[model samples]
Target: MPAFVINNHGGDTPDFDGEITFYVIVCVFLTAFGGLMFGYDLGISGGVTAMDDFLKEFFKEVYEKKQHVHENNYCKYDNHVLQLFTSSLYIAALLASFVASKVCTQMGRKPTMQIASLFFIIGVGLQAGSVSIEMIVCGRITLGIGVGFANQAVPLFLSELAPAKMRGALNICFQLFITIGIFVAGIINYFTSDIHPHGWRISLSLAMVPAVILLCGSLTICETPTSLIERRNFIKGKATLKKIRGTDNVTAEFESIVNASETARQIKNPFSTLLKPSSRPPLIIAILLQVFQQFTGINAIMFYAPVFFQTVGFGNNASLLSTVITGLVNVFSTLVSIYMVDRVGRRILLLEACVQMFLTQTVIGLILLTDLKPTGSWNHAEALIVVILVCVFVMGFAWSWGPLGWLIPSEIFPLEIRTTGFAFAVSSNMLFTFIIAQAFLSMLCHMRAGIFFFFAVWILVMGLLTHFFLPETKGVPIDAMVEKVWKQHWFWKRYMVDVDDEVIKEQVHPHVKYVKYGF
Candidate 1:
């Protein structure tokens, strides 16, 4: 164990270190299946919507428009009901997140994840057997609720279980699984697209595979020590910590977690506490990261990649193949993030990705604006160029914003409001995702090729804001974040008011001297 040292804030901060054990690895792998469910849904919806069979069954108008030889390419799939199939999930997720927060806090992370799996399985069943549009929409709403719970718990579970030094890499497993899910879903869609009248049903039914994995896996994994401790299962918490860390030498870390939990116990209403000036920095940062993440337009593209490719003049087979290629890029790029995030830090990846994504989006927009007309499709070479550019853009997003968006929010908040704060972050992400998924087809119709430019502008804004405002959280201990991160940051420091070292130390842990910020 590393020696405890006095931080510049005049608090004794223990260096809580733990070995990477096999048990921990297994737990993370199982918990991260939650991301697979989310990713499958994201990848499946667009491909299913683009399927001739699916559109003919539920969206007859879209089927007719698609068949029209002279139909405006941008407007053919801009039906509100079609958009609802994709967007309703996110809107339901947004509302369900608040409820998920309470369940995560009260029932613990493992139970919440199990609940997510159950809901997801039911949703999948509904979608697979649906005869009416209403049944499918209801299924989407139910699946959204599952997504809400999984999103709420998985990142937090990963963050809390991981060693501080390994937190970034492990938490990214959630995103890695998400990417893999998308890749798998794309492949499944490609194979199933030719299955006659029931192809879409086969695609929808397969989503239950991941949900079942999550459900069975949740039963096998141990509850996070932080959750156990917060719920006052101290003996079990310490024992579980020792087992996961693969060592019994966890006194310093255990005490730190207990101290943090004690502080959390004082605050009866974490939501109201979030309204305090001290809490505003993390709340603002968490919410803005989610909003900016969506405004980057990644989900819009993921949800409509096949449609977008077809709009650019690819045949059905070609469009599905193109989406698969991009999905491959997305999965591989996220592996790069998992490797580099802890080594190079979050801000560097994010800023670099912004530049890459902006350039690609801009070039793609210029190509479409100049060449592809409302009535004419791009020739083979120009269409290929657009596909390559989109893959480039997806690569940038997968490596940076995709994983870090979930990672940072899950790790930033103090234990007192961790779930509450993350709930807000999840809710914000879902809300913006709902907006984009619902409106992207319409926006594409109106803005034409300019829609890519719209996302490009948002990318530029995200770059500036990240450079100026986002703090580097690399190597900072989760329990000591207020003292080491926020207080050290230039702009966010203003929101953290100074309290007497002794008083703060006493409130957190009397035996170990550590200052806790008012925030």
Candidate 2:
């Protein structure tokens, strides 16, 4: 068990305060459907793009290029218009995240989620029924807006609803569901790929399944206690807290939430307040984590796994099968993360995965550089070795950056800036995702085997940053993080000193004081 260094606060750590209840479980499971929608889109696009029918119907030029027996393997799929079909959603999502922040803060997390589902449903319809390229791109843009809203709200909702001890595991349900969505989409694409003339349409239309589930689920889950209290519905907030905890003895926890909400109410402009020196740590950390997460090149792998396999040496059927194999590896690896996050702590998982990922990336790059050439294909045994190496790399990422990227950013902010801060993280993620998705095919053509080395270097930089700057937040309560985490860190502590002094002047309670942790 992790030890707590409690300062003047008379009670034990808030980590021990609440019991998990069935109601909370149902709520978490439902909210996690939002990730399903996002993930399906990620997995489906590449598979659909690889389908002969899809390319023939929408991208005839690329399809004709594929017919040339001597075409450069790396350059066969490099078309700007084709790339736009996969990348348009992320650009739309980047712009929509700001609007989501306002809706999430003003109306609440539930309504924002509901809106996300509705938009996704509309997008699925447009894409499934599309006859023209213009219609399909328009559908992708609509889906991006829904993805932006869901990404902004779901992580914050899970963090606020879970008990401190279970927060990491529960919040990871979002990532877990994302992996499941990818796996399910892979299965759908594998079976549907055999259906002539309309397999891609079937794959695109199936996205509505998760959106419909989210739409119905959002109506049943209660509003988060923190969100309720922040909106001044104190009576409902306390009642809701009691219901989720499965006990009426919620005075201490409820009081802490109320106090945090009161402090939040005093700040009128959360976005500007985020620019203050004291607020810099979480904000900067949140942004960097999102940026680094994308730089890992995980999205590039997930978005274009089918196309990538085809580029190496695999036939159309074999490439989709390899993608399915990688998808399974991703899902199971995320389950490992859910079990281990709170027990072993975030930093250890991150650091260890960095070592694992760097080695795998280096090996893959060397193999491709030495053996595989731009114009020829590798033998079956060599191709299998590359696939095995890719699975190992995917395993390393699935358990670390993939989930924690969203988890840490959601947990670190104070209530006043919570939604706004998360919006920045979401926007940063979407922007980088757009850049990578848009550029990966071209990069593959130009860089060839060297692309893996580029990502390996980024993995090294992220590991160094994690070691020097990131703090462990495993068991810290959401409301008490500023006192326990920021004020106690070696480098971040200097930034918090002035904020501590101001808190001391404004503090009304005798028991509350700055917490100092030895470990």
Candidate 3:
């Protein structure tokens, strides 16, 4: 066992050998489904938006044939209604995340998630059956509720259950699936474009499938060990720990979790602790990481890549096809992230990805600003270059900000504050989602492609901030991480000395190491 893992809380080592349990994987997979749904909803909407002209024509024909309708000219103009349609989810998510902050902490993680799934079913049904834009907007708000739930719930769940060695990697998988979901949705929309001039009701409606799966899967999975222990469900908590770890390792792991939770409960109220100076640094990191994640305008890319491609003069089929390429890049680069995260660490990936995003976005914006029209029809080679650059941006995000954004919040906070802390962090993220997405269409009309210049500046600033402020947290045990963060902050440094001394002793003294704090 690593020295740091043996001495900190109370001296004890968990059993090292045991069969791997599927319980944790099951939870991860189910929760990942929520991200997948979020992605699918995101990707499909973009392609649907790009098809606005075609849908208008199709709807026009239907209306004209029905009653020679003249008063309700639904197809006379392309209103880009799809843009608002795409953004509704973010608005709903912002609202849901705020509400979920209280709910997750009060009702517990599992039940809150169940409630989210209910919203998913309702939203998906409304969207599928919508006869007007108002109905679709209503569904989006409901769907947003589900997105808000997972945004807060999955990271908290994964961070609590994963062993120290694998926690960062596992937690990042939540982000990975989000990228995958975006990719899958893009691919499906492109392949279905011919049949989808009817407005992609099926593609949009399919989001309900994963929600149902998650609802069913949640039933089989145990509550988070942290939550189980908090409610004083020791036996079930032990059983839950065993299921996540293994029978042989359960005793030590459970004790560690119980100890961490108790230590946190002893200190202060979890929600109020977020206000304390001691908690401020990580909370800042958590909040800003999420803010940067959104401001990088990655969602703008995912939700509007198809429209951007079309605006540049690509054929309709070709524009949708380019979205599939973006998805491919997102998926493969995320796989690269999965490989390097544990080895290369979070800070490096984030820094490099941020720089790459800034450069690519700047170049893309410059290209859009050019007046060089295709000599004949739109130049395929020039368009393809832009398409490739856009894919490069997707790759940059998949490897860094996308996954690490979610990873930081999940593992950074103390146990007592984790659920509530994540709630705040996620709410911050969703709020940005609302701001960027809701205003994106209007901004594009006013600024044209130059709007990306704004995003370029946003990505550059975030990269620099991350370089200075983000802490290195790759393999640190969760319990000790809070104290370490306080030790490094200027205002908290003097007070953290004794705590720092204890940490050093644990590090330097081979006789003592961080013992697992059994839950």
Candidate 4:
């Protein structure tokens, strides 16, 4: 390992040393504790929802009222208040994303993250100590706000700070931590489900561990050099860049970043600037990418894994164990994506994942409908098959959409409007995520295995979108990407051909035709 990993100092020149220094690793990964908190909160909810005592304590009134008589409805809750309780956090996150964007742009990355940690601490406190259902809802909304802020800031923090070579993998670390959080929560849920009412509280409160880590860690790290420079503290920016980069040769690079900031500041309207022809391509791509990510229904699994397992014939303990296995596979698959993202490029991984997901989802749906008829069919062998298929479905998603979904939006936007643009994109994520998370259980209950068919169709659609619009951005310098692709026509024949970065820098302007191959 080298002494430090370069964070957030991208410019015209990129260092390809592939050095993994301890300082750089700690700074980036620990700061990613914010992501860990994101994951833990997501993971905790499923387990808590799965807890029998939790339902008996908090959901007793509704349960007794709707036990025998129920109406089949799309999202009328079907009297399952758990769906509303779970999706409420995402609803709060949707609103909070816009606010987090402003804080990210105005207060700087580290400071914005610090505020997020504060929210997490308070939210976790409320949730852990809650005596009533209303209090738990309040805690979830508060935690959602914290997560929304972290989701907005963390990916940008990684992209802006790490060396160009490390940018993709480092950004992926955030998504990776999300899986780790889910995995940890799965284990906690598994053990606590049998512990009675207090065990549910313990599971929910465990998120505090990562929340505290994020809070204390954010205090130790310096602000991103670019954020500092944008704030007109070029002196401190330069110093911080050197400390993380472990080099004194950041002067030219510093000047380049300063120049970009100055150019963006001269723009009178950040919002309208994205409407210009030069900015349309990246902005549209980023927006649609978020749509595709959520529509894939990964969160439906993450949030409702235990519920799905139980529906397919697994007992409570078995269901939680299967959830834990899913979390483990989710984390490991992300590591695979991080390893190959730069080497293999973004487009192929997305395409392959889409294909695999499409296949797995279709098959999983078919098996559930045919073999396990859900009424009289009781076969452990078929249940095990369903579980295995779900694992394969998760493996398909873990590497592709899960990581790149966050990365592409973070990197594609120009420095001037990156924060604003990305926050808007993330807000879209929360928006669709809320829709999916809220309606997922209803879909499963009403549609049965057809829910898998629903997600499979979406996976196929996302693949087409990727084929037509997504660009091959691996190993391209941030400056080069902004210059070469940002100004191109949105519908141009830029079907993500593998262009040499060196050649890209050599050609200042494009010809009328970008590439011969058109999707």
The digit string of per-residue lDDT tens for model 2 on 407-426 reads 99999987879999999999
User: Could you tell which candidate, 1 or 2, scores higher by lDDT?
Assistant: 1
User: In lDDT terms, which candidate is top?
Assistant: 1
Tens digit of per-residue lDDT, candidate 4, span 130-160: 8888999899899889888888988999888
lDDT of 1 by residue, 348-442 (tens): 99999999999998998999899988997778888999999999999999999999999999999989899999999999999999999999999
TM-score of 2: 0.95
Residue pairs clashing, model 1: none
lDDT to native, each model: 0.92, 0.89, 0.72, 0.77
Evaluated against the true structure, the overall lDDT of model 2 is 0.89
Question: Sorted on TM-score, highest at the top, how do the candidates line up?
Answer: 1, 2, 4, 3
Arrange candidates, best lDDT first.
1, 2, 4, 3
**Backbone clashes counted, model 1:** 0
Candidate 1 TM-score over all chains jointly: 0.96
Worst 10 residues of 1 by lDDT: 510-519
Candidate 2 residue pairs in clash (backbone atoms < 3 Å): none
For each candidate in turn, the TM-score is 0.96, 0.95, 0.85, 0.88
How does residue 500 of candidate 3 score in lDDT? Answer: 48
Model 3 Cα lDDT, one tens digit per residue, 110-201: 87777778888899999878777788888888888888987777778777777766777778777777777777888777766677445477
